[model samples]
Target chain A: MSCWETIADYGLRSIGIGERLLPRSDFTLCQQFTLIGSGLIWNIYFGTFALLFGFFLATALAVGKAAKSPFIRKPSEWFIFVFRGSPLFIQFFFAYFLFLSLKSVSPVFDPFTAAWLGALIVLFLNTAAYSGEIFHGALMSVPKGEVEAADAFGMSGFTKFRRVIWPTMLRLAWPAYTNEAIFLFHATTLVFFSGFPAWQQRGDALYYASYFADKTFNPFVPYPILAGYFILLTLAIIGVFGLVNRRLNRHLPDAQKGRMKFRPNVIR
Target chain B: MFSFCTDPQSLDGLPWLACYLTTGKHMAFYASFGTVLILLAITAPVALAFGFLGATAARARFRPLAWLGKGYIAIVRGVPDIAFFLFFVIALDQAFEWIRHKIKCPDWDQPIRQGNDFVVCPAAKLPLSTSPQIWHEIYGFFLAVLTFAIVYGAFSANVLYGAMRAVPKAQLETAEAYGMTPRQTFWRILVPQMWIYALPGLSNLWMILIKATPLLFLLGVEDIVYWARELGAAKQARFSDYPHGDWRMWYFLALLIFYLAFTKLSEVVLARVTARLSHGQATLGGTGRSAAP
Candidate 1:
């Protein structure tokens, strides 16, 4: 078959859109690229939505973690501890089982038994906990002077926070937040590998890459391709996060740009 | 383990639980925790050596060697570690077997890679294919450790490189003024002081390494996650001694607790270690009052 037809055949194979069966015997480079590229869609979907939904939850969690009241602070601390303490792999397994058990209790959780919902929820909560810890650290580290300035201007409570504390906390948190975001995307690769079954084998990029690796008995080709894709995607994420970082630090003098790093070699 | 555990079915509540938990597979599951600790113990120093070499090469005056080090650090950092874990094990296995094949089976004329199969002579096979099962498990484990070291060595190289840079340039200059050779300066002043700078990053990496132990399951090692899934799956009463319905949630919960407690203990120990390391240094930790970055 022509390359275009080949693409047509396997491009959406991951989502079961075009091909019913994967390229079995004669796996070509084009097939690997096309199929793995299709799988990247799920990674992007899970990473993007988890990050978006996670930000608000993380902020709430960070705030709660920073709260003075034990009622609010205790749960937040425990939540962060539990999620951050456990491995994401195990989290995926536990979440799958939990969701499966809950499926009988109510139809609401049934969607979670599927990788799309279940894995995404796990990633979301996991990232939220990590980001919450990051934000909590940044919140604690936000300059005393900034809050003092707000109080001096007769601002108190929520107004003081909305105007002063939150922005600075975010600004302080952005660099680490960027790292967390990249790692969150990286962590999404674990979804299918975890207990959560990829419905119809519609797995993520690593899923397809591993599939090819298994089929070809050659790790060199497919894994590098997958790595190439991830590195590029990681670069893209860095580029995007870098822009937000610049905007966040626009008011600061040239000296303090929030240590926004290009190389993402931090905690995974 | 109890003598009263002779009739598990007749036992009720906690005694039955004790019997169930002490099953043979459960013993293996418990032993796997030691496997993780042993892997960490071995990998830490080996990876540090790798990182030391890598950082030294990256800082080398020679261009190609520096490029090699820089490339190693960059590529490993860019990919998800799980990918590396999965890929490297198979790759390393094949590479080893292929080398052995070339040496042992030179009379054989076939190419190693023909199609989807990686065919090799049985004589060249790792562990000789007839070695005791324990040897295979050990071999698999050694592969897991090597992969972890390689990947984590790169991570440490990054941290060490940054830490080396964080050392005050003036200290090196003073050593130079005293007519110290570059090697002398690196060992005496740079390496000694880099720990304070590297501590935070290394501590973080330690936690990450701890968290990464479960990926041993992916590497085909019967680590805790493997045992959890195995033992937690529902067992038919007729077929199995410890019959339970899909209790993987509880199994995983126990694993979760294991990890949390491990991480929490590490935090305490690391905090103490950090304080001890920083106590006499010139940085914030060296001061009478505690200072954290």
Candidate 2:
């Protein structure tokens, strides 16, 4: 098939919308690029949705963990521990099987079998646990003088937290939070590889890259294409997070504003 | 394992459970846990060595060497590690065979890439295609280890680079004032002190390495995930001696418990190590000595 024809037929092949058969021979570069790029949609979807939703949960968890009351603090601490302690791969398997068993009795929760809800739940919980730990660290490390100043100004309870505590927590947490976001995006590649079935060959970027490698017995082209896309994606995440970090630190003096540093070993 | 275990149908209740858990395949399943642990043990040191080398190169005076090292660390961090795992296994396999092909089949004219097949001469095959089954398994495990090392090494390089920077500048300068060479300062003053700062990152890396053991399944190694899936798949009542319904959920649950216990143990040990490393050092853990109040 011509390159254009190949594109038309197989562009949406991952979602089971187009060609049934993958290109078996004479695998074109265009085919590799287009399919892998198309598969990236799933990665972006999982990452974006998970990060966005995980942010709120993480904040709550951080706050809960930092709270003085054991009732509020204990569960959040356990949540963070359980999720962070286990591997995301095992989490995926555990969550998938757990969901599958739950689905056996209740059709209402069957969406767990599909990536739309199931994998997203796993990613959500996983990132929440990670970001929760980061935020907890930041919350604890929030300057004592800032809270003292807020109290001196007669701020108490919700007002103190709203005006002083939360913002500082976020500001201190942003850099590590940014790292967590980037890695969580990267971790989305593990979804299909885990117990969660990719139903109808519908998989993510790594999936399509593997597909091309399997078909052509050539790992050179397709994998690099995926890697390049991910590099761009990582940069994009860094850029967006940098902007937020800037806003978070806008009130601080130039020398005091902690620059966002990317740390890789943040407990993937 | 016992005479009564020969006929599972004759066993009842806890006895059936005992025999079922002691089956030959169950033994293999248990051995897979050892495979996971062995992988972690082997990959950690290999990846750390690679990381140390990469960190050294990145900080080297030579621009080209530094750039190459920096690039290795950057590219690996930027891409998802699963992508690297998928890519490297195939790429490395091809690379090794290509070298073997060049050395062994010098007079052959046919191209190695024929359509989708990578047709190397018989001698160039990774396990010679006729090697014993253990050799194939070992070869697969080796590729898995290499892939893990290449990826995790980049992470370690990042940590070590930061740790190297964190080592007090004055300490090295003091070494220089004592008439030590630059190399001696690095070894004598820098490497020893860097560990105090590097321990946290290294511990974190160790936890990540433990977590990454599951990716071995993706690379086609018969690790726990593979065993879980194989043993948990539904069997028919017709001819199968070990017929069971779809019990993958239970099998995977067991695997989850295994991992949780393993990670908990790692966390305890790493905590102790961090405390030990922090002793006499000016770090957070050092100041909070004898555990937090």
Give the top-scoring candidate (TM-score): 1
TM-score of each: 0.97, 0.96
Candidate 1, residue A56: how far the Cα is off, in Å: 0.8
lDDT on C-alpha atoms for all candidate structures: 0.88, 0.87
At residue A15, what lDDT does model 2 achieve? 76
Q: True interface contacts reproduced by each model, as a fraction?
A: 0.70, 0.75
lDDT of 1 by residue, A1-268 (tens): 7779988987777777987877789888888898888899999999999999999999999999999999999999999988887788888888888888788789998788999888888888888998998899999998899888998999998999999999999998898898888888889899999888888888899999999999899999999999999999999988999999888889989986778764343354
lDDT tens string, model 2, B1-293? 97787887777788888887788888999999999989988999999999999999999999999998899778766899888899999999999999999999899899898988889989889988888999999999999999999999999998898999998788888899999998998898899889878887888888888888888999999999999988887877675666777788888878777777877887788778778778877776688643210
Task: Summing lDDT over every window of 10 consecutive residues in candidate 1 chain B, give the lowest-scoring window.
Answer: B284-293
Angstrom error of the Cα, residue A40, model 1: value is 0.6
lDDT of 2: 0.87
Model 2: docking quality category: medium
Q: What local lDDT does model 1 show for residue A147?
A: 89
Cα RMSD for predicted model 1: 1.7
